[model samples]
Target chain A: MTDETMLEEDGHSGGVVKKFLYVNRRAPYGSIYALESLEVVLIGAAFEQDVSLLFLDDGVFQLKKGQDTAMTDMKNFSPTYRALEMYDVEKLYADRESIEQRGLTEDDLIVPVEVLSRDEIKDLMAQQDVVLSF
Target chain B: MKFSVLVNEGPYQHEASDSAYHFTKAALEKGHEIFRVFFYHDGVNNGTRLATPPQDDRNITQRWSALAEQHNLDLVVCVAAAQRRGIIDADEMKRHGKDANNIAPGFRISGLGQLIEAGIQADRLITFGD
Candidate 1:
């Protein structure tokens, strides 16, 4: 790396673990936001922060099973959600309203997520040191 | 109040970048410390020097370049995001065999770890996007 790049790499938290939340609000395949956001989560997993992934609004569809992107021609990235556990990113939450409004049951989602009420989601966000939404 | 700003959109397609620029300017004017300004996704386009908008309109890329100059800001474009958008730097051009790097002044391309570090160090990590 050049000296200029090194200037930005200076100073990392030695052991202070901040609660970092990645909130996905866009659906998969509609736009690149969901896929790109997941890339951030995976890249950031190395930092070992208290990371969490919350799927709300259209983002809830990202975890739905049977996502065949062959027709859409976009890469099927839905399966990557399952591999997040391997990276030690275990905290996954889903907004209850968004799921129900879309007529999706708990079993409809591919990955297991703690269905959170509106107030619960607010409380979860309030506790986070940093919250990033897509 | 130390802040790290995240810009998630491109220069002109969305108001996110414009709002982020104004907010960053206002924050610096208020004498607040800015840890970093991260550009991700299409936000990486804000760091491209080749963007030529109309003469009358505000040149968003130059605005950020000027802001970084004035504030000595650490303006970082995510390496992964930039690569996807073809926003190559001089070093990247050599490494990737890309001709003609188009990165704007005062912006350095780096990893997402910088974003993580910003969250850890800054008082607040503010995100501007749709």
Candidate 2:
């Protein structure tokens, strides 16, 4: 293919990546879904698209400190979250209502996320190009 | 708006299913269209044909089926997860030498492409998983 044709297709709609918002609402070790959601988010991030992660309810447990999955014989992915920044996927937010309900302070979490109220979370959900919960 | 829902938790075992249900209902009530409901992981159980709940409590399986029926929504269950969990269609039941097919009528067994397509087509792709 010539450079002219390549350029024409390069600027097409298909070449434009889509933005995805992942809403995580569960504890990490309790089920396989949490890890699976992370894998999906990672895959989307790898595609060079906008990928954002929102933590709500028990999903905040994924980012909680002192996660001991060793007893369950599961891989501790608490550290993988630190790599999210390297992927340029830094739009991490947490529902303040969920954190407060669970008695978790921001210090109790390994990842630093901006806290928002329920209304704010709803607003955030509204603005997203796509929202997937896990 | 077109919406896509990802249900990754079981109806009986987790609150994710109910949450997804309500969210979908609300979305539809607001005049939004649900493009697809992708059931992955344990969410495949939502489409099981053999679940029997108590009379007093709401029949979640029926509720899901009814919701889909009312809205004319596309309910998609992932093939890999469904097969892994022993939820199979007639063809799969025969191939695996099973005695019965456990998949419900309204739900269709499909692949990850449904999810990928939903993400592409819907304005929102909300997930309900724990």
lDDT of each: 0.90, 0.78
DockQ of candidate 2 against the true complex = 0.13
lDDT of 1 by residue, B1-130 (tens): 9999999999898999999999999999999999999999899999999989999999999999999999899999998888888998999899888878999999999887888888988999999986
lDDT of 2 by residue, B1-130 (tens): 8889989888877888989999999999999999999898888999887888888887777887888888888998877668778788887787678998888867888765567567877766777774
Task: Return model 1's CA RMSD, one decimal.
Answer: 3.3
Compared with the true structure, model 1 gives a TM-score of 0.93
Q: What is the TM-score of chain A alone in each candidate?
A: 0.90, 0.86
Cα error of candidate 2 at position A8, Å: 27
Q: What would the per-residue lDDT of candidate 1 be over residues A1-134, giving only the tens digit for each residue?
A: 12224334433678889999999998898799999888888777777899999999999999999999888789998889999999899999999999999999999999999999999999999999999989
**In candidate 2 chain B, where is summed lDDT lowest over 10 consecutive residues?**
B109-118
